[model samples]
Target: MMKRVLVFVFTSWAVLHVRAQSFSEVTNLLDSPTVGVFAVGTSIIDVNSDGLLDLYRFQGTFLQQPDGSFLESSGDIGFKNEDGSTAEGSTVFGAIFGDYDNDGYVDAFFEDLTAGSRLFRNRGDGSFYQANQETGIEIFSALQGSVWADFDNDGLLDLFVGGDGDPSGLFLNNGDDTFENASANVGYSPFRNVYGVAAADFDNDGDIDIYLSSCSQFAAASRNMLFRNDGQAGFTDIAPSLGLDDDRGGWAVVWADVNNDGWLDLFVANQPVSGAGIESRPGFNRMYINDGAGGFTDMAP
Candidate 1:
């Protein structure tokens, strides 16, 4: 009886030791640490219908996180740390993912900050192929404001890009792996150095109009321009009459229905107002609220 009891005690001790080892292994995996490096993904959207907004971030590599917090993979490009050593080449900003090709997989449009931007068409089997070279979309050379909209009321989506001093590009989807450059035809050319752009059907004409923010510097002379869509390749500039010229070099503009009157109001953010003139406010900001009826009132000092 004594011998049997001793054998049982030894067996139990070994079992407990093995369990502890397994627990430690699991804990170590949970503590697996990695340093995040890039910040290109400035926009978020729901693509996979998983009820979570996936992260379309650029950290020298394209990273897709399902829950917006946890990373699933870095795609073909790898992740790199602070050290000079790299895992991926470069990435894009102003990125939006959607089924642009109707291939049932989300495609990517990212600004190549180091060079030109890129359009990456996703393969159905969890990989991506580059489309920038073939698409002729030059993202890096432009000034960096981009918004994707289905302009022209086409069944397919198109790209409306805004840049600084450089004319914006409109890569109209041809629906056949080709895009047409309609910037000049669309009245987006010869524009002053534009920074940010937003689109809305402001006049409620069943089509979207465009608003752009322009500034010489952060505080120098600047103007906010409005382009009203006249339905087929025609636009009119209505910024001056809209009282939007009262700007200390506008930086960002958005349309909001401030009075709940069903009409969209314009909101403009300008340079700091606490200074003497436009030069006084170095990095300060102001806002201009539109009162409708084609005029804007200053709401910020």
Candidate 2:
């Protein structure tokens, strides 16, 4: 069993690890020794506005001490509890941090597989309250991952929750601490197993677009989707025309300027035999190069 979580501090070049074996065991720095090792996921945020970054481990939370140590205070802050009770069931697929309410406090959004999807609002006192039902995002699905983006350019971050085999949903910010199921109203319902949901201004059109990494074997469903942002809460699928319709077991997608060409490009990670895939097909990674005209060309073979 994994007894400790290893953490590395990269000091030198991002391309090369100048130091050999720079990892240090943080099993003793955490308050809950068991959770420090068992926590498979984590996020960093300053919940207390103390200028120090705190940690949100899947099992609980850890606040950074002045001396650089960590203290687990999930129960006290209301993010997690001793009984590990969540919104519904105990299985958490993932969690994201965002100040959805514009209250200057970073809130948390969790995606659970069995009706446990919840939005925990930070009360500014190092505590959180479940605001799912009040926010109209008490959604449930065979979830995988989630992302926060300002789809409407309303200065409020919206949410996009992905699913595996189940269709995904996009909740738009209502500017009143509530979210509306814009996917249902806008007819952008995507029924596929989505592993990753990435957002960026790929076209530099001042509006954010979305790239969905999906896993499927069927010809019609296997290809991933790239939704172009058309102003005023509208989106159009332009993945096929851009040649980014990869039909393989997909997992993750990221945007970067790999060649420093002043334009954003995309990199997609795939699995030849993914667990979420329907059929076994040898797949390769794809790097989509932007043509500076809001178009993409798959430069990878």
Candidate 3:
């Protein structure tokens, strides 16, 4: 029965005719002067609670109009610092939205490189106020990627931030509006040169495990790390037992049930570094099939 439906869909898709759509240049709609600036991170959310999705660039926020257009409104919405100034000459990498306070409104977190990270509490009226000082999650590091998950199973979202040179941190949510630094206590302090972070329950342990993609310029070799949750707040390094000890430079990572076996497999995107160009010798990506017994086998040849 499913095979007939699949054959019908394939035949219909093969015979369907579609026209290529053309997009018009609408650069003049945005009024912000820093539109062409180097934007590294972006997040789309209904910042105003007006049922319209808004765009958040590294420079500022853009509110969507009723006509499906965007207008820059960060300067008017109190996204500036306490001194009423904007961040300049700093690198912003990741932007994430969540209801950290459980106030029924989504807040924003912007990870910066030179300066510390920033968290903006949504005012529920289209405005926002910087709440990093009150939250205590701000850290001065070269931040790269941010991931949110309930690592402790406390019914609150915790934050995991990846960065360079002793910059990775795990901020455990205090269930209030604040967070506590739990990286060192949780056995994640040794990972210094992390770039990307992801969370999953690879062993089906009900608690989420962490995966970090790390690389360093000073080291001759680098490998990714996987930390299994200890059911407490601490973690145990399980990558070596899982046969993930490759010294390749890894960036992004994700997990999915690729083989329909109800076990989540791992995928790591790698890149070359230190005079190794793609044309000279390309770096191969990796995929690891989970053995459902707390181990992984590299399926990439």
Candidate 4:
């Protein structure tokens, strides 16, 4: 009986290993050369209004087919420059899809490190056109993450872009396919090296609040900020009083009701300082639990 049990276990393990080996590699189907590099952003959306979802990578865009394969379509989809050239060496970071003009078609937004940001408006006829200049939504800075939300309870969607050295821009929708820069007027002054941004109503109020993650290596004090909406088309910084003022290197931020107690909480991702090698100590990730009132406690110990 012992011999039979051992044989049975060995046979089952061998069959599982063989099955795993049967799955072959199909990555060679992509036309681009595999350079073993980090990709900044990837978004899956139907670019041509087709039933199939398409892939948008920082390197280029790919369209999905019925055969479960993707074909590069960045040039065909007008993601290149007006001179019919791609951003060869530029670093593209974030990509998001939203109906900015309420045209029933999802438009695309791509954030670049140095080449500025681009907005691609989707035409219903299965094509996209760069409308950043026309829409008055251009930002000439090192942009990182971007988010779209109706902060002022407006019917149209507004845009918030996080920057590296420049102050983050908040573009309020004018309902006419154009935007007005309202960053200074909305209490986003004294900007640092902003990285990621998240927008949600933490106080259960009708207005949306803003949370920005900042990072730098200048030995300058940097802390993540939270701006509360005043419901009068303005915002107030309430992060320092809420115990969120820390000098850690912040990267990304996310807000959600983690405990499901009808209040929203914040999660921040941190990293070591720039140029800090493996010998440097890493920053700890934090989770700030929100009380039913307006206070927050760092539960990351």
Candidate 5:
């Protein structure tokens, strides 16, 4: 199934094209804008079931107001950093929102390189507290990728974290606010510098498969990996046979039905950021077309 590369320049069903609109920059902040406190990621979600979306940055949070405006409520919600006046804070590499405890509220997870990862449990009253001791999630590395989904169809969302310099971890929700380390149990505890991760049922097998956009530092390349769920909470590295083991510096991996086919296809962004050592392979983006028969064909031109 050597199909031609399909680039998505527009949506699948689009007729009328419109001109791009311009946006004006907003330079206002609550505390005269504490300058820069290393704002990297933001999660806009309905944190309190108010039907209005709220915002959460690493430095603080911006709660939506009734008048369609944003109010700085980071300090009030207990999510703000300690130093913000003179700009002395670190950056949050990645964050995700999920109600892992089956609660009515959504919780947050933040990954910080210098300060380790943290799990913030939502108090259902617009406030949150760190719950690393309660959830059994304590990872520390150059953390980056984070994804939350009910991969096992267990009715609760599971958590996966990718980081450099150590093996990434996967946490399976125990359905009662606590979690257990499922990385080794699921056969996916790869000791690679994992930067990206995503899940999809590429084979239409009723179970979700995982894709790890992994790359190593210090000249050694880890390549990418795809773990097919065994439907029994187990996984197997089925990357080589599917042409998914591209040794380029895998950064981000995403799968979609590119040709509107029933089977899902994959695309990965590559950019090696190795240390002062020679990279193992050249960095280049890759596209893999699912052949619908437990295999993939590289469709990149």
Candidate 6:
């Protein structure tokens, strides 16, 4: 099924060659204004609601562009500020697109390493406006990954931020174009340097919970942490009993029911950041198939 999805996605791109371009070969479309390192785009979205997924990219430095090849304004592109500026020092990592405000328009969120994160409210047109201060999930210095879920069962979306620093956060949607931080009280503080976070209602509890990939000072080959939402205030750490915190160099993660047993399984990609050959190819992506028991076993091979 996953193979078919990948083939269909690539074949559809080949069919709509003009509108859909793969991120692996997008150097020509980029407008090089400043020094930057362009990695392959890891996420895609239609920020303008034009039915075409715009590339959400991370260039080591910033750049400029002329706007062609089905590319829009590179909306909300980051700019380097002077020494005393608010955004003076930071590198943007990843971007996710969603209709966060229930306004029927897809918006954008960005994760930066050195500075604070950004939430761009879609203006219903082609452009976007930054509402970081307005949304209240702003941070000073941390690497972040943004994920969305209807956390409180409020029919509105909330955000979870996985950080490279301790005490990763959760931002609840206030239903009024604003957000509230609820992580510290929810057992998400003292996070021990989290990396990637993915949310799902794994226990059929109707309340969204979280699973995180953590890399900290204590965690050399980091652990995959899990948080269970208890419907009232805070969450409980449930990774140890479920056998998900094995600490095997876990980095990026995604969860799905591979066997369709009504239980969501997990898949984690690992790249050793502390030991030898950290920048090599063919890193391992381990699959954890749910056995309907309380524990999980690695099924990658």
For this target, which candidate reaches the highest lDDT against the unseen true structure? Answer: 4
lDDT over C-alpha atoms for residue 105 of model 6 = 86
Per residue, candidate 4 scores C-alpha lDDT tens digits across 161-230 of 8888776788988999999988889767558588888998788777888898887764344677888988
lDDT (Cα, tens digit) per residue for candidate 3, span 43-130: 8889888899988877778898998778887777777555655642267777888887778888887777677777788888777888
lDDT for each candidate structure: 0.60, 0.76, 0.75, 0.78, 0.74, 0.66
Off by over 4 Å in 2: 1-28, 34-38, 82-89, 217-219, 274-278, 299-301
Q: For candidate 6, lDDT tens digit of each residue in 37-139?
A: 4452246565566665565555322223234343324423332233333232246777676787898887767777767777777788756667788888686
The pairs that clash in candidate 6 are 167-191
Number of clashing pairs per prediction, in order: 7, 1, 0, 0, 0, 1
CA displacement after TM-score superposition, residue 126 of candidate 1 (Å): 5.1
User: Model 6, which residues run further than 4 Å from truth?
Assistant: 1-37, 59-69, 75-89, 273-285
Candidate 5 lDDT at 133 equals 91
TM-score of 4: 0.81
Whichever of 2 and 5 has more TM-score, that candidate is 2
Candidate 1 per-residue lDDT over residues 119-181, each given as its tens digit: 766666545667877766655564546666666776666777776655667677788766777
- A best-first ranking of the candidates according to their TM-score comes to 2, 4, 5, 3, 6, 1
Question: What local lDDT does model 3 show for residue 248?
Answer: 68
Model 2 C-alpha lDDT versus the unseen true structure: 0.76
Which of 1 and 3 is ahead in TM-score?
Answer: 3
Q: Each candidate's TM vs. the true structure?
A: 0.69, 0.84, 0.80, 0.81, 0.81, 0.75
Total backbone clashes of candidate 4, pairs 3 or more residues apart or in separate chains: 0
Model 3 residue 85 CA deviation in Å: 5.5
| Superposed Cα deviation of residue 139, candidate 3 (Å) | 0.9
